[model samples]
Target chain A: MPQVNMTVNGKPASGDVEGRTLLVEFLRETLDLTGTHVGCDTSQCGACVVHVDGKAVKACTMFAAEADGAEVLTIEGVAAPDGTLDPVQEAFHQHHGLQCGFCTPGMVMSAKALLAENPTPTEAEVRDYLEGNICRCTGYHNIVKAIMAASGQDVSKIAAE
Target chain B: MYAFDIERPTTLADAVKLLAASDENQALGGGQTLIPTLKQRLAMPEVLVSLTAIDEIKGISEDDEGRLCIGAATTHAEVAAGAGKYPALAALAGNIGDPAVRNRGTIGGSLANNDPSACYPAAALGSGAIIVTNTREIAADDYFEGMFATVLDEGEIITEVKFPVPEKAAYMKFEQPASRFALVGAFVAKYADGVRVAVTGASEEGVFRWSEAEAALGSNFSPDAIERLSLSGDGMISDLHGSGEYRAHLVGVMTKRAVAAAG
Candidate 1:
């Protein structure tokens, strides 16, 4: 087993993991930070998205050793220290962005990454950025709205509809 | 996934040395394609040499000749954001797999793996890129041998790729909606000397240049030039998404679209 060291959610963490262990497995099983979900083993689904060194990446597709000595931000780390939700999460809550909640964490993480890159993306950009993150329950209409609203846009009619 | 010892090397020489020491070793790029294959138990290697840590082969810059020199470990995300000088190449990188996949996949890995549907091959071959390896530089025509194959020898690692800047170029791909891999992808580049047109996802022998179309488009440089020219379905790929004839048709359509879009 290889001992891996990384900063997870602003905290230093170490775990003994096999070379075959995926980053998502180490995060959820070793550290018990289970907010990051795994929807598909094939890497097509974006449920295991997490930010490694400020860039969003699919955790399931990377080995645990790959994140060694790196800064990792998971869904559990998205909120402020004072317990306030991230603007993306808040927008999701306000806009009814999720149904069944299976895909919300990955969606929020992906959305946050998108906004961080482009703070004021247009509706089409939001849709294009969300191409990897799939949401079967809400049909993605509200997810797009929530992302736009998080960017300070007035998605009122979209939310109402 | 089968268990394997992973070695991370900080320098290109060290990576080459590590790879040379192992008889059964695989080089890892961003691991977008390799990891999935590992997860499916499709490949098993004694040692995994990770190229991500090597600093020498990990940046994008232009050479003295104004060619775009991209490091082997450079991720698609970096290329998409940084390769603006080559807009067609950048656009192709930006549209690969998805956001996450783009962030983790690399040009070196894509070229080495040489998936028939991979986009980078078409870009490299279409633009007549020079494939720089640890040993020597290989022309793009000689770099790619066939589907899932390249001219790289055992323990030979790609260091960088140098692409000559073209006057105009574009890539057009019709994707399989679910997988996002190209159903039929075409890349066309026009230089002062000649035009190069490469098609991926349509050929069973892998990414190949449509010389006939290229020859026709070189003189006229218009959709009308290839109107009478037709691609045969003899070697085109046929899968669940489409038949060989359909893909052959798409190759023609995509070529014309790429020509129009290049300008």
Candidate 2:
């Protein structure tokens, strides 16, 4: 077993994990950060999406050992340390972005990653970015609205068009 | 998941040495494909030589001959961002398995895996890229042998890939909604020497060049040049998603769309 070390949610986190231990497993099982979900095992579903070194990556696809010494940001760490919600999380709440709530964390984390890379993405761009994050509920209409609203777009006109 | 020893080598020489030493060791790339395979127990290697630590094979640059040289370990995100001169290849990389997969998946992994539906092999073969390994440089024509197969040796590590800049190029992919793998993807590249057309996802033998369409479009770089050259359904893949005839038809459609979209 390799003892991996990384900064998770702005704090030092380490664990003795197997070589096959996925980063998601480390977050959920070892660190007890259950906000990150595992919707699919095939890596098609982005439920395990989180920011590694400020970039969007599937937590299930990377071994915890691979992310050693890296900075990780999950849905749990997206907000301010003072419990204030990140703008994207706030938008999701305000716009009714999720229904099942299973894909919300991954969606929020991936959305933040997208916004970090591209501040103001177009509607098509948002849709394309969230392709990996599958939400069975909400039909993705509200999710798209939340991402757009997070980018400082008007949601009132979103429905009219 | 099977327990395996993970070896992180900072140098390519170390990686090769580790791989050569182990009887059942695998090279680890972006882990987009390898990790999933590990989780599924499809592949159980005794050791894994991670190429992530080697910084040498991790950038996109142009060589003296104006060819785009992409390091094997360079993530798809880097390729999408850095390959500004190769818009078709960039676009192909940008849309591969969404943003997360792009962030982790590498061109070398995609090329080496040679998933029949993957986008990179199409771009590499279409642009007439050179697949560079630790031992030798293999042409795109020879590198791709079949599905999930390449000309790489057991201990060979892909260092970088070299691609010639074409006069005009574009990739058109009709994606499978669930997996984002191309149902049928076509990459068309027109150069001073000639035109190359590569098709992926529809073939059983893996990515292949559409030489008939290429020959047609070589003289006339227009959609109409290959409009009547629909490929036969002999070796086209037939699955629940689509039949062989349908995929063959899509190949023609994608080729024409690629030709029209090229520069």
Candidate 3:
């Protein structure tokens, strides 16, 4: 087992993980943070997307050990301290970005990461950026709208207050 | 995935040594492809040498001669963003699968794996780039031999890839809707010496230069010149996403677009 020490969801965390343990597996199985779903073992599906060092990555495509000493933010981390939804999350709810909610966690996380980097993204840019996160339910029309709406909002000010 | 040992080395030399020490060891870069393969049990390496910690293999730099030296471990996002210094290369990088894939996938891993549908091969092959490993520098022409094949010796870690600033270049791809990997992609470069056209995602033997198009475009670098050339389905790869003939058609179409974009 490889020893891994890193900050997960703004908290210091450590564990001895098997070499074959993927970051998604580690988060879901070990940490019990099951919000990050595993829709496809292949990297094509962004259902296991998460933020590693503030950059969105496919958690299924990364080993738990690879995230050592790195900051990891999951769907859980995006919520407010009082458990309220983040702006991106609220935007998704308001815009009806999800239907069955199977792909909601990954979609919300990907959008959060996107807005964190680019607060204001064009429609084409949003579509291009979210290409990795697949949504079989929504057909992506409303999800794109939610992202654009969230991008225009002042997330920092909302988070601060 | 089966159980194995993972080693994260801090230096390139150490990573190479680790890979060299074991025949069953595999070097891990980005893990965008390797991890999924492992999860499917297609690859069962006894040991994995992680390259992320090696600082020497992770940035972009330009020399006095305008040649760009990109660290092998530099992620696609970095490449896409940094390739602005080299517009064609950046544009090519930007067109890779998506932002998430770009954020994690690295040029070194992509080149080392040499997937037939991968975008980087067309760029590396079209640019006539130089791949510098820890041991020696290998010309791009000599580097890729076949599908998922390269001349890289075991334990030889790629440090960086050096790309010449082309006089003009562009890349175009018809991506597979499901996987986002290219169904057919073409990269064209017009250097001071001559024009080179490399086609990927269309051949059974992996990325290969389209000699017919290259010959016609060498004299007249134009889309009209390439439109006259013929690309057939003979010996092409056929898969679930696209048939060999369909891929061949895309190759020509993408080549025309790429050549036009290069101008």
For candidate 3, lDDT tens digit of each residue in B134-190? 999999999999999999988788889999988889899888887778889999999
Answer with 1 or 2, whichever has the higher DockQ.
Answer: 2
lDDT of each: 0.93, 0.91, 0.88
Among incorrect, acceptable, medium and high, the docking class of model 2 is high
lDDT of 1 at A101: 92
lDDT of 2 by residue, B1-263 (tens): 88898988989999999999976999999989888888878998989988987899999999999999999999999999999988888988888888898899998888888999999999999988999999899999998989999988898999999999999999999998767799999999999999999999999999999999999999999998987887888899999999999999999999999999994
Q: Give the top-scoring candidate (lDDT).
A: 1
True-structure RMSD for candidate 3: 3.6
- Model 1 chain B lowest lDDT segment of ten: B17-26
lDDT by residue (A33-94, candidate 3, tens digit) is: 99999988687778899999999998988999899899999998998899998988988888
Off by over 4 Å in 1: none
Interface RMSD measured for model 1: 0.8
Error of 1 at B186 (Å): 0.5
Worst 10 residues of 3 chain B by lDDT: B226-235
Model 2: DockQ vs. true structure: 0.84
